[model samples]
Target: MHLDACTIYRYSSYFIRVFTHIYWKSAEPCLILQKNPTRPIALDLQDIHKSYGSLEVLKGVSLTAYDGDVISILGSSGSGKSTLLRCINLLENPNHGRILIGNEELMLKPAKSGELQAADVKQLESLRARVGFVFQNFNLWPHKTILQNIIEGPTQVLKIKKRPSDRCRKIARSRPTSKKKDAYPANLSGGQRQRVAIARALAMQPQVLLFDEPTSALDPELVNEVLAVMRELAEEGRTMLIVTHEMRFAREVSSKVVFLHQGVVEEIGTPEQVFDNPTSERVKDFMASHRPT
Candidate 1:
């Protein structure tokens, strides 16, 4: 069929437009769109609440952060962002909520003897070992070398003791996390210090790591190095929950972006969907007022 030149050009342009749209939209949903996930639920927070002196912080927040998932809880300061992270690890006690880590349910309320129930304590300890938390300020012990910092949790908190076997020494010396021993917090750059912090967390062999503004304390030029390390962690399939001010990093590295406002979860979705088409007004206001600055 011989068509006029103008008609042929219009049809070709229309087809090209449709093809491009399909191609771009196919990759839209971030990493959560995988067909068959090995574990469906990793951390499920159900109807969680928090308060101080009758002032409510978290008002029935419910959400899930999955295994091998890089999730971001993004919000303005004092919006209970830090509180939520602390609640997850029981660093901050919640008033009312059911926190489930894998199959185990945590006792949010304190017990009579100032101790968790044996089974609950066991599960809490296990989850604590499995979940690692990283601070925004590089919390490396100034007195300890990188090697000591890395192994401290395993040896002390987790009660993993080691004998001086040749194999054990080899493991201690050559362990990937311990290789940073030469660098001290005072001598190392911001990025290196943060990496040491991450290594310290990783040395505990946690299934997931929580990042509390991994790059917030770095110089603008140094931010990328910390982000690169995080990207590497993501590629290695370590589950991570990041609370960051880095909108671009959140967009780039997270499988899910959660917007928190007034101690409540306002929106949760993939980066593109959340950033480009947020369903909530608070999210829209946030996305507009503060971009990457």
Candidate 2:
């Protein structure tokens, strides 16, 4: 059977839209509206621990981020900085811990393997949507246009209508990658792609943002573009947990700095305390090594 180009295009578009609608609808029960909590804590992790086989990655890590706080997680390689970040959203479930977002606690049940898993999958899904994660490597969908990528979560997961979703896409794009809405990810520069990724996360209107070394994969020259966006977010008082090696940026932008050593928090305090007058010998040595000549 011979089909015209228009006919094939129409069929493909219809199927894509229908599939998206149906898939999201199946998860609709898990999508609950968030209520305003009196508590100001945006995120709280208590006594979190993680291990891979015999190697423990995180050891009894606890941190709290009040609303609008920018907390920078710093450590050398294998200090579990990224692992601790991942555990907050359960990208990597911890062996033991408690996590609270706002006033709502993430219910967890122990598994046979002694790992903790989400007790209520629906609730977990609902809470996870409120946390936005930005990766070191830009995780954009190669086939989707930038606009499509930004609007997808709102339109599909949140079931937002076209008009409001369009507004969100515009707001998200306003700060980052405004010129490349029609371009695909492959067409943009590495910095542009990371900016687009940030825009996509912003479109969700998340309560908190987690950046796992967002600029680590970029070239030295391109790093500033992404950092500039993050700096603007900090200035706007966005609650963020950033795992980064950019010591100067952390010192300048973070409300608090946490230095992790050997899977434990070696030191945590204001940027001044951690960077200038750290009491921990390990942290002092680490700071000295990172200090600019």
| Least accurate 10 contiguous residues by lDDT in model 1 | 13-22
What total of clashing residue pairs does each candidate reach? 0, 0
Q: What's each prediction's TM-score?
A: 0.79, 0.82
lDDT (Cα, tens digit) per residue for candidate 2, span 164-217 = 434534444543334555679888778878877887777666899999999999
Give the alpha-carbon lDDT of every model.
0.70, 0.77
Among the numbered candidates, top TM-score falls to: 2
Q: Please state the error at residue 92 of candidate 1 in Å.
A: 0.6
lDDT for 86 in candidate 1 is 81
Clashing pairs in 1: none
